[model samples]
Target: MKDAAFNQLTHARRYFEAKSAVYDENARGWYGRLTDALLSQALDLSVFSRLPDGFRFLDVGGGAGRWTERIATANPESSGVLLDVSPGMVRHAERRATRCGYAHRVRHINGDVDEAGELLAGMTFDLIINTHHLLGFFHSPDLVLGSIVPLLTDHGLMVSVLPSRWHAAFGDLSVGDAERARRSLSGLSWEAHEAPYGHLFTPGEVRMLHTSSKLTVDLLTGFPCLIYPDPPGVASPSAESAEDFLRDDTFFREVLAMETELLIDPDAGARGANLFVVASRVQPAEA
Candidate 1:
């Protein structure tokens, strides 16, 4: 399964680079019709309240620098690092950072999250973020998290976005669509197929992965917050439509937002497409 998944990511990266132009164009279209839905909600601000001014943030498995841009844009005073395992994607992110006016506040690094090397070694941040359904990159998220203790500043918050165990819809595939996507995913990049399709972590699983003496869950809930892709690999929407779609339809935006609220509420019945986790560093428990 690991090998299958890795090859999937490799394929996804190649596919994206081959079609980056079209992919970026179509994504702008989708977001044009749907950005409002994706942006309506806010993070539980408490996570940032305790964070000192001019906070520093590290985006784990962060590529295309999209999430880093968002965070930097939302918090202008913040400086950020866009870390990813893909050099090509890192370059894409660098371009995006320049375009988004976050070039000065951001740095891009290409490396695996599991490696505690010079790139990430001795670095600490007030905030950490991992988005686009990235929790599956590690076969053992707990251990992946264990290594983070030394890299987090006091009161640091780690926000990880992952696919919800219970979500609104699974594309309602007709006949073989689901199977087709499943098979197509096997040869895609891990970034493309990691979450929103390939692997789903339940709320329980979310709690478990980040459970540590170093931190405690500040928030864990389902959010249809992202109209992005299920398996975010080569299959994700293009940048153009991503911007275009959300801007085009109010009803489309409203419903996704309304649905997200329900998924986060206690009686949400099930879950949504993904879970948003905000965990804070905690002092170790007594021995």
Candidate 2:
């Protein structure tokens, strides 16, 4: 690896290690709830029912194994392997698996995705998930995709959640950092002080990346489309009120329902805070 990339990777590892204990706390916030809800819609558990028993899944860059646990619990016959860069996060993931009583079915690896090919050699998954902006962590999306795509079974599926370029630009604009916003829109990787540098992509760019890798884009959409670009720190109505609403399961369900409808809007990819994509190995041409 090059010196700059290695340094960046080291920086990200240290950051996640320090934040490991509190990393799952993000799921407690309204934003986190909405994000997960959106991702769940894309997941559509019904698809998993079609796979044979003891199907395998891999969660790339899955921290603390939250999503892995959810999938494993839902599909009792399924097993999972969670690969992450932070040992602290990997430790927490192991504990989560044990506490959840499915440790036997789940494995944790402490390593970076850049080394995923070597680390997970000879292992292929029926389903591969790259969630929580995993693509943002690397300098090259192709490098990440190339290493991971080959680890999929012939008919396997890969679901990816990518941080939106437009969302980052809007976030910078909301913070009155016009320069940063411009850079974001220009597609340059940038980092906040003490934060890991990340790459953000438009939906089109995402499609291009996968298709170039010989994977067919199956589904591409955005979540929380109706409530995004709401300016930094401000919730839909008010912070306190949003917090109250977030606590109300009924209210959250209603909001998610409305957002789901809006997610199919042709422009949702550009308007949403993040992009969700499902892809698979390109099908061979029939004679």
Pick by lDDT: which candidate is best?
2
Q: What is the lDDT of every predicted structure here? A: 0.59, 0.78
Candidate 2 lDDT for residue 42: 61
Query: What is the TM-score of candidate 1?
Result: 0.70
Worst 10 residues of 1 by lDDT: 187-196
For 1-287, candidate 1 gives per-residue lDDT tens digits of: 33432433544345445544443624544433333233335353335566677999988777677667777887889897887766777888888888888899888987766553467777789887777555554444556567555677877888777654334224323222555445433422123232323444666766766665457787776555445433322343455444345455675657665655654463232344556677887667799
- The parts of candidate 1 lying over 4 Å away from their true place are 1-40, 44-50, 166-198, 225-248, 256-269, 284-287
Give the C-alpha lDDT of model 1. Answer: 0.59
Instruction: Give the local distance difference test score of model 2.
Output: 0.78
